[model samples]
Target: MAFFNREDIDNFDKIHRINLMNSLSGYKSANLLGSISPEGQENVAVFSSVVHLGSTPPVLGFILRPTTVPRNTYENLKETGFYTINHITQTIAEDAHHTSAKYDKGISEFEMTSLTPEYKNGFLAPFVQESPVQIGMKYLEEYYIKANDTIMVVGEIQFFYVKDEMLQEDGFLNLSKGRVATINGLDGYAIPNLFTRYEYQRPKKIENSI
Candidate 1:
């Protein structure tokens, strides 16, 4: 196997280095983050960093690029204190990917892409109509990671709009059954299939093998 230290990685070609670093961590969840500006303009952006922070209060977090350029997602969430995370399914993968293109500050990605944005049940933020699983969130806090110049935004889940059949008896949503897709590297899209489920392990006395 090839080994690379910090210096070796840093010397790689620009795009090549990016792909290596981004993919090194393996596949990441792909979701469409929906937000609305204070001016009532809607915005949706494709994000791969969405991760579960906790379950007690149902908190979720995602990383954002530095505020040096136009950051509609972070700005809109700060302005309105509400956002939505919608799973990217295989059916809408192409449209969802297009949302990442940089657009004008007031331009809505929903208008530019084939993805439809819907405001549900009085929620302040819009949700992707094409997503089978949608989560409404309220902005809670943000921490600036000076080491990377990126910000981590945390939010509390306010509600969820998931298809009833997709939910399992143990409260786990069968994501693969919904055909949700995960991201590889920066732009590769893939749909994972259900393989096998393992039961919780329990310790038991066993004879030693020498």
Candidate 2:
């Protein structure tokens, strides 16, 4: 057996190692923000900064850049108090990536891409019709992480639409099998190949407790 050392044959430093890992942790779920225009032109901008805050209250969160940047998503979420969360997949990956472009104000990324934006369930927020899963959410509280100049906009889910076949036998979240994509790093997306399905714990007794 051979042991490897990180310091010996390094092409990148420790910082690079950490940055790369954090950037490529996994492909992130891409979401599109929809809001009524100040001048009545509805718009959509794709974002991959979404996070799952909790499961009990079904909290979902997304991060946005500062107000000074004139980000439409930031404006819409603040103005409308609602948005749609769409899961990413291999099929929509290219279009999902295209949404990241810094488009002109009032320009609709939905029209530019192949994604179809549809309104359902009586909410003003729009969602991608082709996604395997889509969730409609209502605005919630926001908190500042402090260390980073970022704000977490948490939302409570009204209802989530999911494909029935994506459910696991034990009712676990089976995103990998759904071929749902994720953002690994800052600008890349990939589909994960799942090889493990069981939850593991440290001690043998932990298994019993679980």
| lDDT of residue 172 for candidate 2 | 73
Positional deviation of residue 61's Cα in model 2 after best superposition, in angstroms = 1.2
Give Cα distance to truth, residue 29, candidate 2, Å.
3.5
lDDT of model 2 at position 163 = 84
lDDT of 1 by residue, 1-107 (tens): 99999999989999999998899999999999999998998999999999999999899999998899989989899989999999999999999999999999878
The candidate scoring highest on TM-score is: 1
What's the TM-score of every candidate structure?
0.95, 0.79
Q: On a 0 to 1 TM-score scale, where does candidate 2 land against the true structure? A: 0.79
Model 2, 1-210: lDDT tens digits are: 854366642656777765675674455666666665545455666677788888898998887766556777667766778777888788888887788788887688887899888888887877888888888888888888777678888989889888887877776767776788877665667778878765766756545453
Please estimate how well model 1 matches the true structure, expressed as its whole-model Cα lDDT: 0.94
Overall lDDT per candidate, in order of appearance: 0.94, 0.75
